[model samples]
Target: MTVTTDTARLPLLLTTLLLPTVARLWPAIGATADAEGWPAAKTLATLLEHEVAERASRRIQRHLIEARLPSGKTLDTFDFAAVPMVSRARIAALAEGDSWLAKGTNILCFGPPGVGKTHLSSALGHALIDAGYRVLFTRTTDLVQHLQTARQELKLASAIEKLDKYHLLVLDDLSYVQKSQAETSVLFELISARYERRSLFITANQPFGAWDSVFPDPAMTVAAIDRLVHHAIILEMNTDSYRRKSAQARAVTSDPGTTAHPN
Candidate 1:
């Protein structure tokens, strides 16, 4: 009788339209009300609010995994004071979706390996992701190979088109792409296709002047540099290698008890 009464109280259209999770909330709501002396309606509201938050958290987790971002690197964990030259204000502004993103500005991180370039790039991608943007992270070699295979399979255009869905693409370790015309062409095509339409976050181990050995043709190298730098924010990670420091610290901390005197 109570069930029938409750069913009758809900409009037919509304009952049909109700989400499964919302419908499932009734039992939990009733338990909460009985245990805590909350009004059933208030309990329902609280539970539903929690359900929305949990679902959003799960969605964020899934997006992060799908993004293929390198692990353990976020703005919170980054040692920003260690690299004071990277303008925190500028990066924070960029992460907040300022005019640069909408206007297709790129981010180029130029530094030697092990200097936290990848860490900063991945951390920035996470910030953009938190702001509800779609981002993809891939190594330059892996992405180039994938695109080359797409070209061989005669689906290069469609492949490039599919990549357009992502708001930003983080191409890590750009210096590792072998110095061959085919690889360079594939990579150039990708850069050209996204020009002024989407943003790129590129990490390289060399400065722009040193990129000629990587690109097969001088003209292509010049063109690529021009396009990438037109509206770019260059973050020069000119710091000592954190990896080397960490290793040295560990070695010092674990020194053997016997120190040899001049023998």
Candidate 2:
């Protein structure tokens, strides 16, 4: 078959317009359309649809990479049965919707270590990313240190402003941040800057009563807690550690002589 000059030039024009997916796929789509005796409008619509779907997929992949969520931590992988206090339905609703995020609502998970706070937070991050929302997951101590450096360099406001791009910021292990003026000051600044503007999801091992250990000053502690819980969904996961339960189950399974009793 002889190729027409206009048909050959179409791909180059599409590519120049930054429609790479459409450019690459139009040839096959055009062939199918021609075989089916479809109208020109239908062929163009089909090509555009393929390009839109491909762009959406690429956007999600980029968001997932930028999220930095822990691998294998997703809603499906989280054991909801282990933490009965936390409602799976509520978590699912939060994951599937963006209304709360639009309102700049926060999510605070308080519990002892190994009770799935981090897992749940990371899972929510993964779900939100899939739902086309940008999320960034980082340790509280690490982000605080970065912000402190920015403060010292007189770029703290700019540094915090850059984080405004993400719809949700997941701060894991909030209890691990050192109780120092420098550290707590930057953290408080971040909370204040994002207050009622961008959402924050925090996982902490301590309750609000004990947050004095993290903030140092009583006034600072109260102010930070006030801002966080002002429009927040508090998740109390005071259940037994999942790690301990898994270890116990593994021990029982490994010992052939041990008989496991039904709970």
Pick the lDDT winner: 2
TM-score, per-candidate, Cα-based: 0.83, 0.94
Poorly placed runs, candidate 1 (over 4 Å): 1-20, 30-52, 256-263
**Model 1 score (lDDT):** 0.82
Tens-digit per-residue lDDT, 14-41, candidate 1: 3586544555665666676888899767
Encode model 2's per-residue lDDT on 1-263: one tens digit a residue.
Answer: 99667777887899789999998888788889989999989998898998899999999999999889999999999999999999999999999757899989999999989899999999999999889899999999889889989988999999999999999999999988878646577898899999999999999998888888887588999999999999999999999999999998899789969875799
Lowest-scoring 10 consecutive residues by lDDT in candidate 1? 6-15
lDDT of 2 at 106: 96
lDDT of 2: 0.91
Give every collision pair in model 2: none
* Per-candidate local distance difference test: 0.82, 0.91
Task: Judge candidate 2 at residue 39 and give its lDDT.
Answer: 96
**CA displacement after TM-score superposition, residue 203 of candidate 1 (Å):** 0.5
lDDT score of residue 196 within candidate 1: 91
- Evaluated at residue 15, the lDDT of candidate 1 is 53
Instruction: Specify the poorest-scoring 10-residue window by lDDT in model 2.
Output: 176-185
